[model samples]
Target: MVARERERGFERFITFVDAIVAIAITLLVLPLVELTAELDDYGSVSGLLRENQAEIWAFLLSFAVIARLWFVQHDAVEHVVAHDKRVERLLLLWALTIVFLPFPTSLVAEAPEEPATKLLYIGSMVLSTMLLTHIDLLLVRHPELTDGNGDADPVDGAANVAMLVLALLITLLVPATHYFPLLLLLAADPVARAWHRLRGGGSRSAREGD
Candidate 1:
C-alpha cells in the first residue's frame, strides 16, 4: 500500500508540474492577443504586423523555447518510478521557473532593444535549462527515484550550458549583436559530439534538435 501511494503521489506531482507548464505556455500567447486587439482599430493588417514584428519574433522564440523545455521535462521524468522530498522540492523550483518565464517573454516583446530585457530573457532560459538538466542528472544518480532505464547524457547538458554561457557573454560584450551568438545554439549538438570525440569518448544521440 505504501509503495502504491508513493507512486500515486509522484504522479500527482508530475501532473501538477505539467499543468503549471501548460498555463505558462498559454499565457505567453496572451500578449500577442492584446497586441492584435490594439491594432484592430488601426489601419492595414500587414502594416500592423510589420510594425509589431518584434513582438511576433519574441512570441515565436519564447513559445518554441517553452515547448522545448516542456518536452525535455516530460522526457526526463518518464523514467521516474518514485520520488522523495528532495524531488518534490526540485519540482517546485522547476515549476516556479516555468511560471516566471512569461514575465521575461513579455519584457522581450515590449523592449527587445533594451540590454536588460535581452539578458533577462536569455538568463531565464538558461536557468530553466540548467534546472531541468540538474533534475535529470539527479534522477540518474538516484536510480531508486526512477526506473533503472533512466539515462542522462551529461555531454548534451554540458553543451547546452556552454551555449547559454556563450549567449550570456555575447549579451554582455556586444549588447547590440547579442543574438548573433545565440544563433550558435543551433550547432550545440555538433559541438558536443566533436568535444566528446576529441576527448576519446563515444558520442551519444542528441536529445532534441535546436
Candidate 2:
C-alpha cells in the first residue's frame, strides 16, 4: 500500500510538472498573438510579419528550447519510481526557470542587441540546463529511486549545459553575433558521445553488446 501510494504521489508530481511546462510553452506564443492587434498599423499581413520578425523568431526559439528541456526532464525522470525531496525541489526550481523564460524572450524581441537582454534570455536557458544536469546527476546517484534501468546518463545533460554556457558567453562577448551562438546546442549530442567514450561508457556498452 505504501509503495503504491508513493508511486501515485510521484505520478501526481510529474503531472503537475508537465502542466506547468505546457503553460510555459503556451505563454511563449502570447507575445506573437498580441502582434495581431497592430495589424491595422501596417500595410499588409506581410508587412506586420516583416516588422515583427524578431518577435516571431524569439517565440519560435523559446518554444524549441522549452520543448527540448521538457524532453530532457522527461527522460531524466522516466524511470523514477519514487521521488525524494531533492528531486522535487530541483524540478520545481527548473519549472520556475521555464515560467520565467517568456519574459526574457520578449526582451530579446524588443532589444536583441542589448547585452542585458542576451544575458537574461540565454542566462535563463543556462540555468535551466544546469538544473537539468543536476537532476540527471541525482538520478545517477540514486538508482534505487528508479526501476534499476541503469539508463540514466548525465553526459548529454552536461554537454547541453556546456554548450549553453558557451552560447551565453559568445552572445555576451560578441553583440554582433546575436542569438546565432545558440546553434552550438546542435553539437551537444556529438559532444556527449565523445565524452561518454572518453569515460569508457561506450566501450563498456559495446563489450556488453558483444
* Residue lDDT tens for model 1, 1-210: 233223888888899889999999899888778867766666778888888887788788878888877876776677786867777787788788888888888787777668787778888878777777787677767877876665666566667778988887887778778466767677777888777668876644433332
- Candidate 1 stretches with Cα past 4 Å from truth are 1-6, 198-210
**Lowest-sum lDDT 10-residue window in model 1:** 201-210
Screening candidate 2 with a backbone cut-off below 3 angstroms (N, C-alpha, C), the clashing residue pairs are none
For each candidate, what TM-score against the reference?
A: 0.86, 0.92
Best by TM-score: 2
**In candidate 2, how many Å is residue 203 off?**
9.7
**Model 2, range 35-76, lDDT digits (tens) per residue?**
789889997999999999888999899999999899888888
lDDT of 2 at 60: 90
Top candidate on lDDT is 2
Cand. 1 TM to true fold: 0.86
